[model samples]
Target chain A: MKYAATDLDHFSESTLHTIPLIEAKHLNLSFGKQQVLENVSLNIHPKEIVTLIGPNGAGKSTLLKILLGLLTPDSGKVVRKRHLNVGFMPQKIQIDPTLPMTVERFLQLGLKIQKRGFFRREYSTTNLEKYVDELNIGYLLKQPIQQVSGGEMQRILLARALLREPDLLVLDEPVQGVDLQGQTELYQYLNQLRHREGYGILMVSHDLHIVMKHTDEVLCLNRHMCCSGHPHSVSQSKEFQDLFGEHTEAIAVYEHHHDEATCDHSHGHNHIHLDETGESKHND
Target chain B: MIEMTQFLVFALLGGIGLALISAPLGVFMVWQRQSYFGATLAHSALLGISLGLLLQTDLTITVIVVSMVIAWGIFTLSHSKQLSSDTLLGILAHSSLALGLVLISLQNSVQIDIMGYLFGDILSITKTDLWLIAFTGVLILLFYWRHWRDLLNITLNPQLAQVEGTAVKTVQLQYILLLAFMIALSMKIVGILLITSLLIIPPAAARRISDTPEKMLLISMLIGLLSVLGGLFASYHFDLPPGASIVLAATAFFAILQLKKAPM
Candidate 1:
């Protein structure tokens, strides 16, 4: 159900033609003496994919949390289109071993019926199944949620996030444990999803090359807004180079190989070895 | 013969009521790794009892109040960054228990059996105690029925639960309050010291036999009921302490389930 946008906020009304789904301006935060984020400003518009790229300790997750309102920034304001629904995929939620939950039930937990104003919508079983089938995770539905393989786990989390039917998807390191093949497929799917649903996508990724191909814009952060622009321009910026080291040139090789589906010969070989070792390690 | 049967009936009903609520609470307590929190509440319960005796108030009511106050106190204190939660729990648990011992001993006007409070005197459960158990059991049932998913979500991840638009803080506060009430009412049947055991062991045993949350809850309740029955029976025939016997029976179930070959 859609409520009439009668009470639209000034931010939305002012930009009547193309209102941003969410906007954060001049965000500054600090924990005691150390500053985590400073003067970070970004806005997500409909059908846009913004990739937040930063090294460890760059406060990428913290920024995402501030955007999601999970944390309160010491200063700066976040504006959202009125009644915006955000589907947040956090980095690695550790489920306790004692809690026995199946993947189907884990997905079901994401089916929260949000009530904003007089409108309400029901996320049905069919919708859940549609996502499950779309992600090819139907096989894993009956298995214990904790026991799924890394690649399958990523798909399952993406499915859970999609179950919310969010206006904007905020994923923090969505492909942390996923293999190279899985990562490419996930980025492709996210791009396709954005085109189909027009949902704004804001995701944080540690890998610059794989994510840069799909990202409309990139924000390079390190305790501040180091650089922000199109992925090409951001990579060209000196600040981005200084922060990420001389790896800027290496992004070209990956970008060239990204289009060729048959270029994963080496990746496929290592993936098997990684999976075996990972499985053995997990058993312990 | 009638009097003996009457006492048995009261004990059984009270035990049944505690078992029903304890399963769900115990499952969550174990899932959240808050068994220590439950123990802390149980420890403070002795303080509640002493406070009741000194003030000439109903022991059950005073225990519930003191438990809630202590639960709230711990909840707030845990937010401070100085001391870890277990450290805080350890401090609160021992100090309140020592204070309770002091208060109980200082009061020369009242005659109280400390052993009964520690290990429980289930056979001596009064009709009033059974009513309190039933009332608390229904209240907890109604609560879980409404917020079962919410509790599960919270257990899985509090931040995710908050993002999903759950009233995480509110649900958590209510859960703490209900847990306080459960511990207070349970102190009489299982005694204050053994209350956490009742809220923990049945679920621990049930974990072996179940593969789903709902199944675990139901199985734990069944296990808890069985322990109560077996313990009461043992107490009658063998002249054992009922609370200790019940806890032992639960441990026995845990051990027995361990012998069941792990599912292939």
Candidate 2:
């Protein structure tokens, strides 16, 4: 638990005192006869990153859709602060080949739709170049969106989401196609954005090791709220170990050497050894 | 000779109007992979034709209304999860068309040229059809001008669009209704059977040559206009069916463009 407390680190401690950017209260949903989500609730405050991790079909996406107001929960509701602008990055988007759209045009499309209410002043206009350069997607701008590689597509999508200049960013598997090295860079970048802009980030991810180091809260879901707490505690919890099995040990180690603010520290070669074990378990 | 000249002018104007509106709409249909949806709408339009004839009402209005209703029906039924959309579309398309044919055959006193409805009589375009196409073209342009970004956002991903504050359902419903109106208006020039061809071929041809959505829309419109002009000329000289001639001309463009491989 010993870690350096920087000026940026104070926000994590003070987040609970400030009103949440978005809050979900005892949400429940079902599709026909099957219950999809049950009594799930979570809060996302500014300068905080909450990662939702779950097994396949664990209602992770369902919860996100509810949080975004894309789907109405059968019971319970999501509350957002007035004029809260949300930037969403979906898992993957399949653009029809017949629709010829360049990456730059895709980013620009985000700027075209005027968000409802008066809260879009912060994002202003024409942040497309800023995000494109930051995400390192400048070279892919003129290329057709459909032609981009998977990793490039992820960055392009992230850039598009960032162009919205949202107060809260909801990313679903934001680093899906990115390599291990790119994943760390993206997490570092997101951490920077959170600290610099005081924005709240809610992401769904399966990359427990990388995400664990960066996220303030981890909501482990399996059609219900299995566990919710700091990533370190959640990884050690019985529910997490039961759900994720052998991967918890590696994540716990990954979480220890890393602190929220610093990204330059080494993970030690022993951590890589654990990552292979986690991957091999995944194959089984 | 003057009457012939007037007939050609009206046909050209009406054909050009339809082509202009079809470009943006057809490009979307192709992009959304809903080409079958357009065909389904056109097929059910025959039911509207039969109803209009049976009720002795204005055929165009009734056809437009029925097309809208069918389009709405398709939109709602697509959520049922009972069958794949293509299967559902196929069932609705042929059944409504069959019902229209059955209803038309039941009428003993009225004499109608079934071939004219099936293939179209573009050379016999009246002033009323021209006005309706012009009005629809205006409406399509206005709607698209305001909602182009929204529509493109939705096409990229509806959930993402919804999150970004675009009313996905409302925008989608409006687009579908406009598609119905366009299909109804196009029936007179292309006929119910060939209407989808007019709505699909130009966009498909344009895809080979254009590198952006806006460019595709523009190229499709140009291709559509050319098809109308070339088809009219060929039909005038060779005494061929204008609707079929127009579709063939579009197909020719699509074939010729395919020879130049599009850059990946």
Candidate 3:
């Protein structure tokens, strides 16, 4: 559970060659005078879906922003492979209903508009229509952005991000405001993309169950990382246990050791506990 | 009555340029909800005009220089952590306007036509004014053309824009410079008093009709052009101020569009 610093360093170094997509060394971050992240080192690989999971104010969003190159760390080397196109789906900001914009127009923006110059590159209306169709929101292409549902907007954004065929996708709470069905559908679509394209996905999410089921890896962050590995292992580790507490029945079942005596575990339960003499002990 | 030919020609050129430039930029401003900022910038043009009068320089050059200075000042002041943006904009907008008024008052011998400048005189637009307007129009077109994607990216999401290798500060600089030019040149047609309306109204009207930003901009320009021509005709026929008539025309267009039953 408590891997030594040297062990982590060794693991990081050895894994660097095989699947290194992003590597950060001795990262230190601060907002004004307050230190937010300290002596953090992490590596993310290609085709890996890393979820930054933590409680509120655990610096999950901050670390994600840093990874996206939105914020600069005070002391760190964030080495990314050259020309790595990163597609970002930010947390939904409040959009005014009166403002008029369509899904098709929005998707066209994601294409490399800067390459040809602004307003100079004339977008084919047919091509934009095709891209919006590919997003499965062809029906919503003509609707006002303000009029669309949150789930629909998220899809439109997803379509926009995918238009460029990015190398890496950075999503911050992609399913934050969507309904249950919408969330499921989005994840299914994302999973399909992951399987097909092998693009790296780093998502910051609080939906533990879905993330546990869907993601390839989990990066448990609490200012400092508690663990980063397979979700099943990371969730069962002492750090996760200590942080989330031994509350969930499934996790408790996983954490319980067969060699330990079962007497103390039945403190508040209605079930019986037996001693070595096979005599029942009842608190009531 | 004013000559119809002169009115049509001047209004067409000025109105088209103003509409095209402002509609796109205004959408950006409105999206960012920087209407107050736009108002402040427009108000600061008075100071630029006054500075031009005081320096005995080309009016367009003087206005451009003064507005750019005010814009740079505002940008610099806003960047400081101490002052809030609203407080800064309020102080700068009023202070510049007041300073411009006082300076103009002090220059008694120059015999400046303050009313004409404020209300606009389309008939009075000389060839020099036309040339300046044309040059500014081309500059704005080129500038926006080159940086359109970057501008949209920053407007949509500043943090994401930074991540995507956009030089946000530099883009912002370019945007402000273009805005200054637009405001300075627009003063000849719409006048400083009504310039912000021209910048904002057409876009607002067009947005109600179009679902896409590109279409919105185009529609806004069309609406603006119609208002300018209609206002000019009305002004010539009915003996009214061109600026006031143009603004009223735009407002009427907005009202008519609102009265339509179907949602855009």
Candidate 4:
């Protein structure tokens, strides 16, 4: 279905009214007998970057998979306002060296290829080439998918997804296994795409610090959605504190340390003091 | 000496059709990592051929019916919780091959060229064979034309395809039917033992040089046609077996393409 330009404006209005682009209600997912996601409810707004974060075995990826239609939840209702053309960038895909596909070719596969009545149109290679250029992956277009570096591969996948001009982009750890520079570049490009295209993004990531800075909302999912709202609010929620006790404390300490370093002041002498035997005291 | 015009016509029709059907089907097989599935299906064709011979029926009809049955049966059984696809395919592949061998062996009176059929007998292809191949090719082409998008979607991601309103299971059945048709017809040209090579090798070879799926498929068809024609000609001159020679030609082309500079 063709999406009109006004659709973005309508979507933005809906979000203002607290109507989600996608709403998952009372979702229950189980693999065999073990429950993965239990009564998880999530609402994602349009043109907003929502980050799904949790500890290992926290069903972050499972929730993303269910949303992307990769996994069918055992019981729940997922409501969507529009037919979402979802562009998914899965966690790292291992390309066999024997596979002789290029990045441009990979991207074109996502496009709908149709034969006209009685006459077939000559295949055009330029459309995807232009997309590769737009995604800043021109050099990667000709290279074998197997030979490209992880960051380059991620870019190529992003370009492939973007070529569809999808309404929503779902990324499962898009920056996982990439270096810091690569992660930064990917985030920058994603931000640019969202601003220009107004496509909604739902990203599942373990890198909380990076996501906390760029995302519009944070969904802390541990079996069920523990909290949902602004990153700062979720991070400070009691549920988050209870679920990630020591880890959350460590993050708070690190943030405080970083803030103190940036502000050029000794903020808290009590929390950072010398212990017996000349050892530095730290909160556990 | 072989008639140049007749050989060219044979190569053009047979090669092009084989290539067209295999290219798309092969891409799915590779994507699913189901190369073994093709081999199993090809092996099962021997049972079809054997049944045809025993019943004194038309080879094409017998082979198609038998292959489709086995394919459908395997498809059904694989769906059951009792038997996995790997286990079922292994059982069927070996049993059919063994049964065909035994049944053919029992007939001590008739002198059939078993090796030629096993390897390939491209030179011995009759007018009826050509007609069957051409008609089956059209059917496959029509099928592919109707479900091109659905096929690609399922190949890339089945779950997504299902969610996007495509009948994933129905598409899968159509794929198996198309593959069965291709394998059944290809057996007469490449032989049951070597049919999967024609289905898989050309696509694998073309994958190195082409970028898009369509281009890769076109290149694969061209490669298959060239290999078939070149191998037939080479076998005629060198007194080699046509099937072995064609497979060798394809292998050589694969090696050269791999050694050549990467595609731009």
Error of 1 at A195 (Å): 0.5
Give the DockQ-based CAPRI class for model 2: medium
Model 3's CAPRI class?
acceptable
Over A127-215, each residue of candidate 3 has an lDDT whose tens digit, in order, gives 45554775679888777666788888788877766666667888888888776556666766676665567677788886555554455
Model 2 CA lDDT for position A280: 38
**Residue B99 local lDDT, model 2:** 96
lDDT of 2 by residue, B61-114 (tens): 999999999999988888645678999999999999999899888999877777
- For every prediction, compared with the true complex, DockQ reads 0.43, 0.54, 0.48, 0.26
Error of 3 at A271 (Å): 33
Model 2 bad stretches (over 4 Å): A1-11, A112-124, A257-284, B79-83, B110-113
The sequence of per-residue lDDT tens digits that candidate 4 reaches over residues A3-40 is 12122332223355555668788889887788999888
Worst lDDT run of 10 residues, candidate 4 chain A, spans A275-284
lDDT of 3 at A78: 85
Superposed by TM-score, candidate 4 places the C-alpha of residue B44 at a distance from the truth, in angstroms, of 1.7
| Candidate with the greatest lDDT versus the true structure | 2
Model 3 chain B poorest ten-residue lDDT run = B1-10
TM-score of chain A of 4: 0.76
Interface RMSD of each: 4.0, 4.1, 2.8, 4.3
Between which residue pairs do clashes occur in model 3?
Answer: none
In model 4, what are the clashing residue pairs, if there are any?
A: none
Question: What TM-score between 0 and 1 does chain B of candidate 1 receive?
Answer: 0.95
Candidate 1 C-alpha lDDT tens digits along B124-233: 88988888888888888888877888899899888888887878878888899999989988886668655777789999888877888999999999999998899888
How many angstroms is residue A185 displaced in model 1 relative to the true structure, after the best TM-score fit?
0.8
